[model samples]
Target: MSEGAATAATVATAAGTAPLRERNGGQILVEQLRIQGVKRVFLVPGESYLPCIDALHDHQDAIQPIVCRQESGAGYMAEAHGKLTGEPGICFVTRGPGATNASIAVHTAYQDSTPMILFVGQVGNDFAEREAFQEIDYRRMFGQMAKWVAQIDRTERIPEFIARAFAVATSGRPGPVVLALPEDTLWGKASVPDMPRYQRARSAPAPAALDALQTLLAGARRPFLLVGGSGWTAAALRDLETFAERFDLPVGVAWRRLECFDNHHANYAGHVGWGMDDALRARIRDADLLIAVGTRMGEATTEGYTLVQSPLPRQTLVHVYPDAGELGRVFRAELPIAADVVSFAAAAAALRPAAEPAWRGLARAAHAGFLAHQQARPAPGPLNLDRAACVVRERLPRDACLTVGAGNYALFPHTYYRFQGPGTSLAPTVGSMGYGLPAAISAKLEYPQRTVVCYAGDGCFQMNLQELGVAMQYRLGIVLLVFNNGMWGTIRAHQEREFPGRTIALEFDNPDFAALVRAYRGHGEVVQSDAEFGPALERALAFAQEHSLPALIEMRYEADGIAPGQTLSGIRAAALAQRAPAAVP
Candidate 1:
């Protein structure tokens, strides 16, 4: 046959209707998500979700299914994807243990304000009253954390319910949405409606609030800006950068929101709390007006509920948030506006007045000082936390995404790396371990074009070590760098310093991480000596490219016996001083 004839025949075959009916419940649910622009779905398998899995396979071109090892890991990966793409991350899991395991990531998304959709399989109608295997009330259990939760009892309601769930999840106060798909209903048949596509809702800031913010900006002798969280869109970030530059105002990023601005920006003043330098902090304290956008300015970000030693007596705080409850929940605010972050920022930028010469000059000098301090900070030695960050930052592709687990190992990435894109880095601020590997694999699945790396410590990685097989099974090209300190470094630092010579149960005898990775049919290597670090990293990256599988690089470094901000001895001595009396002269 001629080439053209062969192409025509192939097109005819491919264009035919699906083998199954359009009324299939699982297919409808998947189609609803497709219409909403969701392209990836991460999951762990179980009997309850067999129907949903079948439907996902039926619509494979529209929604990609990423299988994971653990339910929590799947959720973490989905959260990371949502952060990166500004699209609702979809994840599927079975009921009971599966639902409970996935619940943690819901809280993670809620706290982070990440947009995600979780599809959980529930017991069949026949087993609901009999306590069927792996069955639990996910709706009630996840209600507190999710923006929306529903159990689909009928196949016909799948389209409407899921469309509503996405709207609620991605609208104001974006967070996780849970949808429970009953197994029997998924297998059952009904007419699937072609629901209207989901559209994100954005509201403009209130006129009164906009006028009030403008008035403050025009009248202030010293004004500051605090940017926080992932709610701000790229255009909003650009507007903020421009506004700060135009007015010469020093901007303070919320603690752990390094991705909000380039660390090298001239108008940047370091973080508001959590190891922020005293000098820059003092400068922020002196500001007469504070503009907070898209951030709760919560306890952790405020350094245990205090921005300064004492609240600025005359400072006017204008907080802008998507959630009404988060406003003025921590500190008193002169003006609290409930509006979409990006829209509000755009409006504020348009109305902002020109900066006075004197105030602009002061802010310029403050920004310069901040840059000097950043440069003056010492680098961690080879095999140290700083070196690991430096290597990855310099060598990794500019667009690569990273997943970092909670521990001392995470501190370096938080403090050292500068993120240029949204969702460039993923980590649980509430301090959850065992998230790094799974999140990395999830990122890779969501964005196959970019490199993905997960930074984890010995103790943290051990908690979810089984995920390595998931990486192999899917042929995920992720790089896993294990910081092998052989102890729960954060807690150990405290115990060693506070209780000198006292052995605590915080230490661990680590398995050979390299051997474990190799056992899973992936490349593995150890970097213990200074000279071997560069070579080992090169080999690992090469392995990732050659085999298109996960690569594990175990890096060993000497324990500095120090916490992130204080020495172990310093903490212990502080405790001792509080307990002991001064010597009598």
Candidate 2:
């Protein structure tokens, strides 16, 4: 026996008649996860890792295993968990097809800067190079998509690999890590000590950097504060709030990062991203200084990198990020501070602002623009998304978590919904559809006390609707609002603009969404008109709470209601006018 095994045996023997327990790599892996304070794991069951599932059975009381219908849904749930808890979300899947299916969530984690760990069961070591059943090189497949990828060939190394996985996943510029486990190795016996919980190294801005930032802020006439990315704690958000208020800085959240700041704050500017308000774009364009905190200022956040010029932005840019490597990678920064969000915010809060600048008028104007843009416009159809957003904002609890997948339907919540605080919004920055339902499930599981709502489009919801079974099985009380326009609204809107009445493969004869939910033994409702939404939402919320199961509400709208302040017909007309032949003269 190995020395580690002998020592474990001796300890067991000393406990008077307690038999020495022989453990496999699977058992060790689960135990290590428990030691790392992982309370849950999302997974899709497979025979490739039967031993892991069996081991999970023993640790069910300590670590709840949520079985999802599809690997993609499981991965999305894990990603959402990571976003909410600031730890590596855990997901397990089988080899080949399962791993490929779960890659979407891995990509989302990479782009969104959320920490996650994906474990894939592999073929036996003997079959690895033979291209045997369900065999694939995970390292090559996930090389560009993940921060780190490795395969464990020995049972004894499980502890070391798992500990490193957690550390790497949560470290600077957090992202997903992929670990492959061979079936035979998982079944092998080994004694290994579990590592303690992992902690990320925090970085603080240098005194010089802070002084430079203060000087810049003191001189700026119109400074804009942009906040985004993960690695945020409640304390960090509180510090950011105080920092924004102290200087009356206009704060704008990056793409889908509204939860980073309180939207109702007096200094709040509108979010900067796709479908952003024109007024907010003007503010970004006219700003004399832009202080970006924790955000990478990626393509989406920068409106295809057009809002701020590349290499040298038109405005002076002060960029703060946890990773030094990310600093000045895209847009050149006049002052770069390599500090974590919380640390930088705390340091910035210490600086005394030069007597309230005469430029406070610009900040107030930005806030006014944000408020004006949030006011919903009248819809021509009975099913008005504007009204729905308002009703949800008024009805849902202030701390309720709202999740959305990609679609024009998401614009309503993005524009009108008020997130009272951090950790309240979970939307994919990568524009992945079908993310909302799984994320909502994970959010509800993480915070059962808070209400959870998922806003999905007809096409978006169907992408992972199979996960409803997971919700029903786990008894998660999440409310789903499906905007049913019988078409891929965003795609159709684009086609109308570009093709000018040439539409193809955009419409769908969808399943009865409400009936589909009911088939899963959950409550379902159909709201066809504006007046029906409030009562339907109340019923859905009450049903979710009473049954402890997900409730679905299918909201029907006319095809012309493509998006806020835009319609399919209007787009087609404008496109035709642009393409029409001019008179000879």
Candidate 3:
């Protein structure tokens, strides 16, 4: 037979068979993962999961394993991978301490609505419930942290549990799931058929709902669009942009969800969360119609549920979410639409908007306010954060991924940098510190061509600083930007506000981060001024690109620059004035 005919015959023959084969439970689990298109698994090897690790020996070409320095770092990388790919990022860890360490990322994935699966190795089935070595009840431990948690003791049901884990993780309001594998069960032999790739179910808005939304939009004077949450595809983002532009609606994202909308878009308003713009907050509070899409309007986004009052909002609220349970769980919406964000956006894009929206000027004003606030003013001290932020904005790639942990220093990039599109900014909305560096590593590993920058505070950087080894080992280029202010800036700022100079345990001495990265055989530099930052960043980026290794640049600043607009001394003065005796009353 000719080459074409021979190829067709081979395909026909292969399709006729089930491709089933006898294998150990561990091998069968690996085969199922391979079938699901998993490219990598982040892990810290332990003895309990040796069989699975051994099974991985034969599939090196199929799935690459990322050996991390710690379980938290590994889990963070996995969570970041999930956020970037919209797939269930896989992570494996041993029981007890390993599981506890990984819980940080599990909670992050849960709160951030990212899809991830954490497979924890458990004690052998023979040691069940006897408080054996490194044994912990995973179901009880991870019940609140994970979307679903279960232990698989039966070798025959490996495929079933793994498939269901993926389904539960990627389904409604995508989040993390946990599966525990007993050592003995993983070593047992089993013959199981692999599951096909899981597909997420997309729910679209009803025609009546769309009509009602249109009616609400047509009559509104000041309408604002709040978009957030995960599970957004590129096409969905495009649809969202189209809907916003067509309706001349001002768009604001919830908390750290700047990735939900292009910050450069004409309709883009400021982020609505902690350290949010006062003008944007006013706009959100005063809007006649508020359309919340995808987001849960969590505490941060809602300003502790003060922006949109609970039970009943001051403005007419239209809430849309993927999970039906979350629609009216908090604030009762005027129109609650339980549909996938992407599907709803696609359907909303098809609606015809009013030829002359009454609130066109309101959208323009909102966008103008956002643009105005992005221009950072001169800050105190020699190392001006405003200038540094401006340098990053002007020098870095528009689509470069910027990750940040919780700190007052984050306000600079949060206000100054403009995210060009979705999935470019990875920040922890739940205020998880030390997420930036690990997330940057994962971003680079997933998209090697894209530039990944981690903006971390002195305290935040040290939280997962050991992950630099992981980057070096894998040859992934990522830039670490450390903002060294010589204290816990956010806590200090709050202390200054509340106690008026009673700063106690907030201050601490930090190591030379530049020297720290250099100790790891990575490029390092110190930038003392605004002019020094550009050259240092350029050198770091060039070094990372040329060597395919991690780079760190430490920018030194004073403690008085607690935040962009407020100084520590100013806060103290205000507090003291508030406490001063009122004419011996």
**Please, what is the TM-score per model?**
0.89, 0.96, 0.96
Weakest lDDT window of 10 consecutive positions for candidate 1 = 372-381
Instruction: Please say which candidate is ahead in TM-score: 1 or 2.
Output: 2
Which segments of model 1 are wrong by more than 4 Å? 1-22, 308-314, 355-357, 373-382, 494-503, 561-566
TM-score of 3: 0.96
Number of the top lDDT candidate: 2
Model 1, position 190: C-alpha lDDT score:
63
Flag the better candidate by lDDT, 2 or 3. 2
lDDT of 3 by residue, 441-463 (tens): 99998889999999999999989
What C-alpha lDDT, on a 0 to 100 scale, does residue 537 get in candidate 3?
Answer: 92
Clashes of each: 2, 0, 0
* Clashes in predicted model 2: 0
Q: Evaluate all candidate structures by whole-model CA lDDT and list the values in order.
A: 0.76, 0.90, 0.89
